[model samples]
Target chain A: MNEAAASLVADDGVPLKLKLRRAERAHKLKSVAMIAPLFLFLLLSFVLPIGTLMYRSVDNPELHRALPQTVAALAGWDTQALPDEPVFAALVRDLRKAQEESTLGLASRRLNYEISGFSSLLTKLVRKLPPEGAGVRDAVIAVDERWGQLTYWRAIARAGTPLTSFYLLKAVDHRVNEAGDIESVPANEAAYVTVFGRTFWIALIVTLWALALGFPVAYLLATLPSGPSNLLMILVLLPFWTSLLVRTAAWIVLLQSGGILNGAMIGLGLIAEPLQLVFNRFGVYVAMVHILLPFMILPLYSVMKGISPAYVRAAVSLGAHPFLAFWRVYVPQTIAGVAAGCLLVFILAIGYYITPALVGGPDDQMVSYFVAFFTNRTINWGMASALGTLLLIATLVLYAVYGKLASSDANKARR
Target chain B: MQPYATPIERVWFYAFRVICGLVLLYLVLPILVIVPLSFNSSSFLTYPLSGFSMRWYEEFFGSHEWMMALKNSLIVAPSATVLATCFGTLAAVGLTRGEFPGKALVMAILISPMVVPIVIVAVGLYFFFADIGLLNTYAGLILAHAALGVPFVIITVTATLQGYNTNLSRAAASLGAPPLTVFFKVVLPLILPGVVSGALFAFATSFDEVVVTLFLASPTQRTLPQQMFGGIRENISPTIACVATIMIVLSVLMLLTMEWLRRRNEKLRGAG
Candidate 1:
């Protein structure tokens, strides 16, 4: 040991540890070189884009950019009352400039998200600007009654900053009020909170339905011999591999009012009239459950396959009822799979867009539907980013929980 | 499992099997219904078929729009599959074989595209691509699709690498074989099944994807699912059923190939 320690020093008098590290550095660099191309690709394609979208949730630069002079003039005036004549004059100047630059719609549409009437109000004021010598405040107030209200000025002042929480607040159906406090919007104007609630409620119901239906099949697959189980496993996997759009299309064919289910029931004399099935909540739930059932089953079957049947037999030999024995001895062992599957199904369902959009009615749309609506239909990128951020957060949380559950299961098995 | 079973146990067993059978039927019924309906003479997607006909399939083949979308999908899916397989296989090898700091964080970031909601991804890519003038272009759509497909490739390839023996590569290196030759001759042959399956998954993902394409693609660049989405939204006809039936057959084939590859992988490992 003494000779080895003495020989550890190199001929040049460097220590062995540092020499080893210098040698190991090449291997480390090679590994990093292998991973760097993909890392850079994903960073450019995936991570940066999501970062840009999240930034849009707080981005309120258009209003500030278009109304620079108005924002500057309003800075000194307390928002306690209506803005003075100079502020109104500055607004007139910005409006005329914005109109000439073909940016009036963009500026006003941004403010319109804050207050309901600002869109038309700004457009109307732009269209009906008084003759060259006229007073700006009266001209604006005369164009629209909303310009006389303090609430409109407050929303504008709040949105004057480069970054604002207006869209995020509105995403949860809340808004900044005249008194500069956060509060809920009027009951009728409130839409997002209800949609979010419906998204979660539908997701929960679908998760439950998948669990209910998947449990029996998973149990059957676990208990059966290898041959039949493998065949049945293919049935589950085939649906899992099938195109999502195809499955949704199938549901539409079979569940529409004049479709197969109704026709079959009428043929069998179960009902005289065709039932309203598709284009409603029922259709959404039915299709979502069908699409997500495989997600529920695969985890559950793997877990159940690991559980020994001797435990149930031991319970039954102890004079417990058979159902009680199975439930008490076997079911608890599958809870990890249940948690993983339910969380996965719920996460996927809440963000579902294609199924509900095809099969659902007006009232059946979820939060993701609104996200798409604002993105494509209305071009309200702020609201879309805000809603998308919220959904992303919820999904990430649930996914973290699933990760823990899955890892712990793996750890337990290894032990 | 059937040790001294009571009548209640027997009933429960049969009932459970029946429920499982029904559930399986539910899983398969949707894909099955589209096949016959696509051939129906009537345009409606309902029962009581007028007669068997191939008009819808003809229409699908004849239409410029559908053919264009099909062409676009074929182009995008294969390109995305190849890109994803290359990047994902390299990263999986690096991760499994190399010791590194922050390895877990790297894996998490690589797989996160699969976890994040597609709508979020679509919206993000729309805004980002629009800023860079990549929107409405095939390059943008293919990049986005490739990003989405990478996670599947990484997952499968990493799983395959778990059973791989590292000493074989070391032995080859000691014998004066170059690194590339060792990889092609020893490691690649062993992991080829995993790579192929992963590529299959990437292809299927790109083929079935609609949301990102909707955000990124122009009307001229629409893929099959985007076309189907528009068709389903604007009109309901047996033409969509025809397209859907074709997709079902494709999925079945893909599933069988995956199963076959998995069995081959297991056999190779057992023999080795």
Candidate 2:
């Protein structure tokens, strides 16, 4: 080793490269320590819990432990036939085992939460079964009169697996039949499918309404002097900074029958009586659009501010009408901003819970309302987690599609 | 300030300007109305007040629950701001200066909090926090708020770092200063605008966040927004209007301070 390297090195005569390697190792250790806190925070707070919540979607403990014999016996039974005497006896055996194990109560509560009255059905049937005997079928049939029916057998067959597809199917308005194939629920019973549709419809309407209100203001912000523009922007952002609950509450007072809007209308002699505004879809839309309008304007204003004034001037000088020039030249450039703002607003509107729940009629409630219903009111985490997963997947897919469209447009712009 | 314009064009501009000014007034009317109504002697939250008084504000300030929520918020907001600023600055620095692989993925993950719907995030956090016994604790609430606040900090800091010059740090390093010392003495002072802006954004975001707080906080740890939420649900108090007025004033003051800081930073950057 050279003199300088030797001076830096240990008395063991380690090579210069080895010493450098050791120093690198020490540096990496220090870097890892620097990043450890953030990584640990994410793991403990975000990653682990999401992992567990997602897992609960398929966690079917009751089905696994309670009906083992019936599940095993059903493997041999003909799909077309009602379960025979042996299969019925096998079910009785399973119910007795489940009762003796004392774990079926939790399962019944969970199932009952999903489709009300399942707990009583399962409990009565389980209680009627003898400790061990041939008369078990007669006893269970006495408890649930529908026990011998094919529909009851089908429901049992549906719940046979520990790894359940139940929650996922319910999320999409389908479930397993007796033959173990997916089928839609009765048209009248289907709720979530319509709720998802309503979510998108409300989102689309809210996006359009916000755009209509925000576009003119954004134009002003772009055209005005810096002082006026900044002042106007603060007004726009003031509502955004305030608590959403406070703002929505204010809307309630403003929109209620005897509230400010009606009081003003009455005083001005515009209407004969107080109008029903709160607790309706109209109120929900008005409040949501008011709250979300800033999201649309901010991006649009920023984009408009960046466009050179000369381009519009250039169009005017070239025999193009002002409106035509504005639409053809100015609007196209702001497409990126419009797209971003629409996507942002639409995604937010779909997941709206507080505003809709507070102001809207029962029919105006969206998929997220049901997600919360399962989460809090019913305490059905499985269904809630499944619904959440469906929404997440839908959001991811929408983003992917948006990313594709954005890149394709960018490519065209380059060309 | 006068640029050449045709009479028709000038007319069009003024028409649009008046329409926009009206819209801005409409937007601010509710808040402006509430401030006066908060001082109304009458219990109702309506205009044409029954003489000026601050009884509602007095009532809000007197309540132990409201004061406790304000106290909790005072503790949580700054803690969240500090945590978010630190992690956000680290992530922003790592993304901007380091040529590591998967940089784009990491950056996307950092910014995803901004795009994701607060409802979904809150639901996810609710279940997640419950499992670890963090559902009601101040530490849990602060961490959740910090996580939510990080995106704003990242966006502001990244923008600031983009304007920063790396050559100053390189020069300091070449002059026998350690990398850490070079970062502190040279780089940080230069990008202090970004850091300050990021910290301000973090604080504002925490102060405003409600959905996650609704889900994650316990009765004892209830925030101001949560308290307002309960008031909206259970009572018809003009006190909520007072609370709203106070929050608006606080936010405006904070924003003005930040704007001042931003202007000073811009002037300093130009001079440097």
Candidate 3:
């Protein structure tokens, strides 16, 4: 057959293949056109902001923006010793600009991250700076003697880099020592590692507890007849549907020192006095588990519901023990649900800010608390972004695992 | 019924039911506990019912702060819900209908708001909104909330669209109706329940969102949850319980509405 004649033609004698390609392109364009509005809206309102956050973690703009001339001038200076006249002159010029621009505190605030008292040192240096003069270095040193130290100049140099790992390093409880190698801070200052540890630890405990409590309830819902199961399902769903603030508020009311639960216990003479329930680890666990149990149960119930009872019945009829048969034949079918539910609960638990803030004690605060602390109280954007990036990493990694399990489960169902 | 033959089996059966019952009790009890506490007449939130009164509810409704919060919630939740429903439904339809490159990545990004730590979002938006002068404005809060609400609408609407048959629309189109008419007449009627459900979800999301409001809202724009957060944090009062009860009732009503829609959807599918 002739190649030209082999292809079919449309009614207008155009090649059908080209026509089909044109039609497909039009369809895609239509779809994209429809999606563009929402996509752009999200990009501007949500995704861009998140991107800004991730960037802020390592952005290092404060030092770079405040002292552009000093940062540029220090690029050629070796870390071994003090700088020469031009570098001091650039510092003077940068400080004058910062003073006039009202950004003197920024460079100093950044240096303070490296050394404790550097903030006030830089502030005083700026405040007491006489008019631009020949001996700017000596004048600055006279204002604050610490400014003459090489260590402080090294901090300025380290922060003056366009992108600094200072915040990220600090987040893991490590610091760049005077020798320029990463090392753990002294034991007393090493707080973030413990905080991260506690975050994951709390999340794990809550996930396991939720699974322990939710599995049986999910099993009952799966095994019961439709009439009873539907009624029982409301108990799970009503709480799930309720506002989180309301649920957390209710827990506060129930567990406060003079609250109903403690009062009830006292009235019944269950204990000599009211328990220290709220604002502690015990309260955190109870509220978190209560908040997250539905996530675990709903997934587990969906998975258990699909499993046929016949498998277990047949195993028992064939002389296998009922419990063993249930475990062997039935339990395996629900792993997908268990994995999804546990991971979901763990993920949510780690990101928890509101519930823990309300119910947990000072020691019970997690990484999210520090993130908010840095953002709100301290105005430490770098620190906030660094901790947030870690959480974003954990969430994405776990979400990837969950995505795998869910898709594989779908595949199993397809078969 | 004959499944249990051994004595251990019978014993395990009762024990399992009792355990499940307790779990259910644990799930539902906290929500119910506040209902009575809200009605308690005592100034201090104690037990044994100091006697029922509507004083707390009266205070909640009568306070200017609570009333303003309620007004703000009404304004924000509805506007955000409308925006989320329109955009999310359109996007979900497009996502389901058309083939696209990087569809999965796009989807993941769209829903990432629900996954990312809200604190990070708050910080990022805090700076961003400040830059654009959206900080402390009702528009800023509403826009942020709408973004948060979009994922729910997309998830639900995409689900409904997946279960849809394209043949009905094809028939409508072949009968000489325009594209918009086919959509409004054939496609929308089938998906209206889903849209409504998604709207309810989006509404609830906006209504409940506090972290974003904490960063974004000025005192003039304080929301119900923000006000409650302050109340719970600064001072413990039954008025907070009263607010919680109202929120609980609202959510229960939403849940019932969702259930009704689910049944109706099933009936529609069955009839079809």
Candidate 4:
């Protein structure tokens, strides 16, 4: 062969390097072409909407949308005292325009979230305003003395912006005070911080319970002969494939006060009366653990199935205790599965809404319950989205961890 | 467990089996308890049936509301599954074949809907759909459900493509078959099981979806889960149990079908 031969060339006029580059470019283009329809569909349907949802947590557009001049009037004023007469004039003029547009409740209801009284205050002003716009500030003040107070104006000024952290702050049990410093709401008003804690608490309990129950079952499936193992595997997968609503409904029927569990317990004289099982935190734990146990078991079983039993046997043959050999040799190999399963079960558990709502009492509600409450019961989009954003953060962070573990586990397997 | 283990070790083995048996019982009990309750003659959801009867089953089949929900579910799940399979199969092939920057990022975006809480996705879609006047429309529900189903298709098809032999398609192309023809003729037959299972998964996703429907659907567009949700919220009825029993049977059938397909797929690959 020629030691320093000229670079190879394609049959085409182009050099080989450029030809390879063109081929690579074509490959990328083909893939992108295939992915385009789905990518665009998801972009419009899933990605964009969630982006808008995250934006909605800090969004307070109703006041700004309906009362633009009033917001502009308060642009220069700090959160100190009331603004000058011009700002009041701007408020009254904006109020009439909002009324004429039939959007008074839009501005007033948003302002009411910031401070509790402005809904009625502004709602009263639209009807009491003069036939004309002149002396409108006095006419508005005559309608409600509280509107004349700086507290009311501060509420307006704080919420008047197109973007505010009122909802996000409120989600964490903190709010922007009249002084405009971020402060915790009075203890009595604090609710969401507890709800967030309760969500995490419930998810953790479910994960632990699932782990305890699933480990032995997974071990049984992994170690047993094919005959018994297949039956056990079906037991796991059957519940897994069942409808989530059906399983939850089953729990409701079984755990209700006069339901089967109670009926059996009383028949056996296990307790004096039927216990409060469903519609409480106990039922939440029971149902969630039952639902998530398969997720826990499947991963652990897969990892355990790959591990050879010879290592444990080797330790036992070397005069080590059987329990010691099994624990030291076998358990370490399954940590990846354990972590994967626990995180997965935890992630799914935290976002549970239908099961908890169907079985849980008021006090047993998780953050998702409150998210639905704000969306459905109160029509408070800000509060709903803020809590949702928080839950999304929790899930995404855990998923990232899971992805890391999973990829590393796969890399190890490949090696 | 070793044959030469001490007495305690033998006891531990037996004890472990019992514990595992109890856990298996726990897993199946909730599912089984609903069956007899669905057939109870009385109106009460509690135990102690007055008599064995088919009244709840009759009510479930006879009700207009339940029939409408079942029809809506049927309409939505199949349409979404079709769209999801087409998009997902194409994307999976594209992803496996091409080298591109930010491929991981694209995959992450495609799968994000699966991780995000249903409540978040529901409200987000609600407000966004309202902007384009899609709320309460069947089209809106179907499109949203289809988006949710696509990731499953992508995942299953991509997994299937991983074990694929590329030389067959290359041979087809070399014989002057068009790329589309090679895909349809050479590759499609081999990967059909993956496509079918992915479609089944997508269908299941769309069928079981309720929270999104809660925000998007009106009374007219209510799905089966939403109907059950309303029933559970308002009152405990044996009819709900009857519906639950039917769904459980459906899942059992689906599981058996999946198991059969998996074995058949394995056998075909083994022969090849």
Q: Chain A TM-scores, all candidates?
A: 0.91, 0.83, 0.95, 0.95
DockQ for every model comes to 0.79, 0.44, 0.80, 0.76
Strongest candidate by DockQ: 3
Give the number of the best model, judged by lDDT. Answer: 1
CA lDDT of each candidate? Answer: 0.89, 0.78, 0.89, 0.87
Off by over 4 Å in 4: A1-6, A78-81, A130-143, B46-50
RMSD per model, one decimal: 2.3, 4.5, 1.8, 2.0
Q: Candidate 4, residues A1-415: lDDT per residue as tens digits?
A: 3332337677876667778788889888999999999999898889888888899999888988898888898989976666777777877778778777888776778878877777887777776765434565666677787867888887787888878889889999999886779999999999999999999999999999999999989988999997889777989998988888888888988988888899899999999898999898899889889989999999999999999999988998898887898789889988998999899899998998988888888888999888888989989999999999988999999988888888888999899
- What fraction of the native alpha-carbon contacts across the interface, defined at 8 angstroms, is recovered by model 3? 0.78
Q: Evaluate model 3: give its TM-score.
A: 0.97
DockQ of 2: 0.44
Candidates in order, TM-scores: namely 0.95, 0.88, 0.97, 0.96
Worst 10-residue lDDT window for candidate 2 chain A reads: A27-36
The prediction achieving the highest TM-score against the true structure is 3
Model 1 C-alpha lDDT per residue in residues A202-225, reported as the tens digit of each score: 999999999999999998999989
Interface C-alpha RMSD per candidate, 1 decimal: 1.1, 2.6, 1.1, 1.3
Per residue, candidate 3 scores C-alpha lDDT tens digits across A1-415 of 5566548898999987788889999989888887889999998889888788888888887778988888898999888989877777888888888889898776778888889898887777777765666887787777777778899888888888878788888889888888799998899998888999999999999999999999999989998999899899989999998999888988888888887788888888998788999999999999999999999999999999989889988998898887789889989988989999999999888999999999999999999999999999989989999998888898889888887788788898899
Model 3 residue pairs with clashes: none
Q: Model 1, which residues run further than 4 Å from truth?
A: A1-16, A81-86, A127-149, B1-3
Please report the interface RMSD of model 2 to 1 decimal: 2.6
Q: What is the TM-score of chain B alone in each candidate?
A: 0.97, 0.93, 0.97, 0.96
**Deviation in Å, model 1, residue A168 alpha carbon:** 0.9
Model 2 ranges off by over 4 Å: A1-40, A65-102, A110-117, A401-415, B1-11
